[model samples]
Target: MTPEIAAEADLVLTATRAHRADVVSLQPKALKYTFALADFAHLVDGIDEVPPAQTGFFGPADDSFIGRLVDHIGKRRTAIHPIAEDDADIVDPYRRPPEVFAQMAVHIDAVTPPVVRALTLE
Candidate 1:
């Protein structure tokens, strides 16, 4: 993606290790808002004060858990760094064994509930 286009993005979600560098390089300024998918999951997992799941009714979409997660993660970015370059990555399961695929699915599953709650607050 071009730097101009990257700059226009509100947030950037990259799915794997390979795409992370390319996306980060495209918009240096976007680093704070950009996250590898699993990395984001990990980041939010550590935040204890995230609002509890809500139901029934929600206000504007921007005021939801996703928005709050983004804000919290951005604030914590300076203090949090991936222990290894691959720390934020979800390994690619294609062409791999069933066990490998299952492991990847587990990783995704672990992060799904909070993400879904955050996105679907009401």
Candidate 2:
């Protein structure tokens, strides 16, 4: 990933720990915002939900809600960091069989809800 892209990102998500490492290597500054998809879900298990917020009355709703969520995860990183680093990895199905791809899908599906809760309004 380009440094510029990483710089502009509000968050960086990867499917696996290795991919997350690559992103962090390229843009160390994003260490706070970068996360493996499942890893982030796992790490945030302890963080309380952040209710969706409305923007200023005069302005349009924007990405600030998401930014606030990302910030909370960053703030709690150390306390919950290592809990799932190894177990949270989603298997890569890049060149595997149909069954393997399906397995990967299941894995993703299982982990998606928590990530959604962590990042989305609904």
Candidate 3:
């Protein structure tokens, strides 16, 4: 996505636009997740609807599967890295990337629904 498009997407997800007033009060994390879930919706969006046919059928139930997925997806996806890691007491979202900033957007699209549901039930 172009920088303008990415910024626009962020605004929409964050409910900054007047047209999305119905969803404006959504939590920030939920908004982020919604963005991520939307990004990956084309791939494994239906996974949540059905339980796995077999737990370990795909691979061993360990870190490998997750690691592989992140590695594979993370490359094409834009990553948001910390601006600085040496300061233990600071929490700032001031980082930029040497590559494109697609990962954060992808992550936002991928993880939203469950996070929203979990918060709603709480």
Candidate 4:
């Protein structure tokens, strides 16, 4: 079920050339990643607890450990400033606003999925 779920999700994500490129670039060495289903499930439960750092929409919470995780994973900080209302670079036709991608990365880094911490290609 997990594989199926993940596969379906990936299929939806990699359907287009541009999206495929973005996904591939976000995390190139993603095959080595192996996320624990149990941990992911637990993460899902507390997922909403993690806040956004920028737009008040899933931004990082003050004094949270996610920042440390991002550092541990060696995730370079990239500012999302100048994000326009209809910014193509930040918009995902496959899902909600593209800003959510950054938000998810925070969660993935903090949780450090045993299978794949940095699935993003770039």
Q: Count the backbone clashes (under 3 Å) in each candidate.
A: 0, 0, 13, 22
Off by over 4 Å in 1: 1-5, 46-69, 79-87
- On the 0 to 100 scale, the lDDT of residue 117 in model 4 is 33
Write out the backbone clash pairs for model 2.
Answer: none
Which is superior by lDDT, 1 or 3? 1
lDDT of 3 by residue, 1-122 (tens): 23344333322332112222334333332232222233332223233332222335665432333333323333334543322222111112247673324655444444566434422331
Which has the better lDDT: candidate 1, or candidate 2?
2
Inter-residue clash pairs, candidate 1: none
Which residue runs does candidate 2 get wrong by more than 4 Å? 46-48, 51-63, 81-86
Give the top-scoring candidate (lDDT). 2
> In angstroms, how far off is 23's CA in candidate 1?
0.2
What are the per-residue Cα lDDT tens digits for candidate 2 across 18-120?
9888988888877878888887877666456764544657564434766667766665676664645556678778888999899889988987887876665
- All-Cα superposition RMSD per candidate: 7.0, 5.4, 16.0, 16.5
TM-score of each: 0.62, 0.76, 0.21, 0.21
Once fitted onto the true fold, the runs of candidate 4 whose alpha carbons sit more than 4 angstroms away are 1-93, 113-122
Task: State the C-alpha lDDT per candidate.
Answer: 0.67, 0.75, 0.33, 0.34
- Model 4: per-residue Cα lDDT over 1-122, one tens digit each: 24444333322222223543444455543222222322222223322233333333556432334433332222211322222222212223456776777765554454445323322211
Q: Which candidate ranks first by TM-score, i.e. highest?
A: 2
Clashes of 1: 0
Candidate 3 accuracy as TM-score: 0.21
